[model samples]
Target: MALLVPPRSRTGGIVALVAHPDDESLIAGGTLALAARAGVPTGILTLTRGELGPIGDPRLATPATLGEVRERELAEAATHLGAGWARCLHHPDGELPWVDVETAAAEVAAVLAPLAPAALLTFAPDGLYWHPDHIAAREIALRAAALAGPGGPCVYEACWEPETACALVAAAAARGLPASLWGLEPEAFGSPTDGLPLTRVDVSEVIDRKLRALRAHRTQIDRGHLFATLPDDLGTAHLGVEQWHVAGGPGPDVLGALLGEAVRV
Candidate 1:
């Protein structure tokens, strides 16, 4: 594995496409924060406002208003991560696969045309935990990246390092943490079997920022949730490094240049 060296010149910016409001924060917030701290303009486009997600508090939002509430929460999270902007598409939650791919691709392309981020981050084909919306978002993002042509942004998928993820899951289980809180069942918590090249970005410095961004999505995350309950040392051990697998675009690895120090893992 070769270290991904940072680019010599800043090109455009970084844009993350996600299926729901908190996906950006949960999946790649630290990376976004790191990029922002490095003076790289960063943004996020959530395909849906996560209207179907379980509400943490009824007082915060009702069914009819959950979409709006989540949208606002996403914005706050993005701001906390130092993102330049955050936008949402009104696709129905849990039904993104039903959306017309061409239409979704066009909408995504439209968003990318203006910003032209050097790197486009989104879920892997497996959708991390095999969420339908995540899969759909990844498909749409890939289509949009293709539409962007030769000079388009490099596409990267948020990924987990298998051994490390398994260890974390075991540790969490040992602590009596509920799988539901982390959105994973004990049997389901591990990296995919397919071995893909990975880039690991050390985000220890921005872990606090990432936690704040996660907390900002109060509508989805409960006070006693796994994210909030993890001891600081465990959190650092599990979340300090964000991992990405190149999904599309040119070169073996281009993010190191676009963001900051990154190494092959």
Candidate 2:
């Protein structure tokens, strides 16, 4: 597919709601960076500071200080993505499923009210990796989008192409990496079989920015174990395009128009 730049004349903005600090970068950094480069205002709303995530280096942060460190890292990543703003709810990590759903939805709705983003990007209902926090965030974002009504932003969810996921899993196995490392299970990581219609965005233009943003979260990502360990060709091929499912949007075509030719419905 040919790459197309989003029109600079487009007004309004995009807001990404995620469960944790680096979730935005991991899932949609390239798209966000591209939007920012196109003059579309962009922001991120992270529900948690990711305090419970594995610490790559003990010197960087402790259990007590991880939240603070992650907050700063998230801010730095947003800067790299050229996001107009980023906010954290500082909710306890790993506890989102236990939080009051209505209350969380209200808070998310409040954030969306003022931004009135053209689109709201978030994780799919399966939460991509089946993380409880991710699922909770997804529900909250969907409810918040609904509360915003017709005039509010269209909602999109990042999703993996089944073929792409299978290929990555095969590659990881070839490298002797355990299936658990990639979160694979007897049912192929518990991915939904119904599947979602995909909209592909060629993010080659802003891949560097995306990588930089990913690297910004040093506390959570071990360079050698995660990013660096991926076979370069496979990594490039997979990361070059970001995919999304129109979750609560007016229509897939509407979102395609907003994102331009970069979006393939």
Candidate 3:
């Protein structure tokens, strides 16, 4: 069955290939919202159902249940953000136990040929927070990109800028804030600070929507820590402006350069 709830599409289209349901919110929420607000078409390709998550209930994360629940939530989040289509490749959540790169890449390639997005979003090799599933998702996207051909879509990595990351660290240190939120490590604490460059995307328009989506994943973000200390506006203020490391492009700033526009936010 088709996973997405169709939306009213606009001129330009964007496709985001990610590892899980919450990933679109955590990583590219703002951008997805921006595309929707602009009336641009936006779609998401989540490679797995996130069934392997370390949640307390095993039954809740079952392949059948988790897949459908994830699909439901993803569709809702997309509608909330005005995104276009949402679909999953249905690959096993954890280690395939038997899948190879070429096979997975072929699955992704089939989707790309039809979507033909103006821009594509996915994880960097670092996998942002170092989730193994995320790393796999990145590889799939890269291989799919190659098969789809260079001219298919402008790929964007959902990543933090090294300079901005360092600044975030300074901000946390100067403020005497703990290096975690809800027991989750601080965004800048352990990530590579430099030597890895990135592109910046201004997602100010839908920052509020992103926050709402994040909250929707109550299972993950409810542990209560840094997020509680900062007001929603303040927290989202940081998320409003996003950054990415472009894997293949003229450079990190290719989006701004190619789009010929920059958001002041």
Candidate 4:
């Protein structure tokens, strides 16, 4: 029989597994920041250095500079989120989807076994944006979560509900900001039925950290344009809220319900 525990009692230790450097910011930075603020040990596992990313400065995208630049950016951003450790897998960008899941899972398992976080976070099916690498990362994380075994870490997937996204776009438009590319098109938003069943994670507390982290990827995203195009209030109303599909395991909402500290939507 499963042992009972008090609500939000299991505290400390959380991990985020993603395909690229900036993915942590776009997808799960708020949750990361929340974990850090709670004094929980948080780890980030980046599958690639994002060498394939196209940037305003073409030179920054080259083989030699890309890795170093992205690594630095990732480190700085992770620091802003109060992340404890950041590990790079160095898989070639755009090529990760083709990597063997078992092999990838084994590598992830090795790291996770030692850290022993209470939860593991990752991408959902359709990859949030349908990027090939993102999809592969999801597969790898799912396998890794399984390999992590019972009492290891509960798994979670990033997800944006259709109704919520629509409301967000309306709010953005009211604030004179361009609707999110995906929000503008139903097809781009991906399948509604694909997300796993779980609780939504509110992230109002560390929204600024997420913004700061996103700004650190200057080559990929124009900070000035982001601020000018999307005002803080509007951005907060939209991005400050994030959701997750928790994979029930030995623990229920070990990270979200416990250390997450925000109301669920």
Top model by lDDT, which number? 1
State how far residue 230 of model 4 sits from its true place (Å): 3.4
User: Which RMSD values do the candidates have, in order?
Assistant: 6.0, 5.8, 4.4, 7.0
Alpha carbon deviation, residue 216, candidate 3 (Å) = 2.7
Candidate 2, 88-151: lDDT as tens digits: 8877899999988888888888767766778888988778778899999988888888888878
Worst 10 residues of 4 by lDDT: 1-10
**Best candidate according to TM-score:** 1
Order the numbered candidates by TM-score, best leading.
1, 2, 4, 3
Reference-based lDDT, residue 86, model 2: 78
Pairs clashing within candidate 4: none
Runs of candidate 2 exceeding 4 Å displacement: 1-11, 163-166, 169-195, 228-234, 248-254
Cα displacement (angstroms), candidate 3, residue 177, comes to: 12
Which clashing pairs does model 1 show? 6-256, 6-257, 7-257
Error of 2 at 239 (Å): 1.9
lDDT-superior candidate, 1 or 2: 1
lDDT values for all models: 0.79, 0.75, 0.65, 0.72
Question: TM-score of model 1 relative to the true fold?
Answer: 0.88
Backbone clash total, candidate 2 = 0
Instruction: Give the lDDT of residue 201 in candidate 4.
Output: 66
* 201: Cα error in model 4, Å: 1.9
> Model 1: per-residue lDDT, tens digit, 1-265?
1111223344498888999988998788989999999988888889887999988889999999998888888888888898878888889999999999999999988777866678889987778777889999999998999899988888888886556556766677689873245555534433663656778888888888888898888887775576655555666788888888887423546678866464445
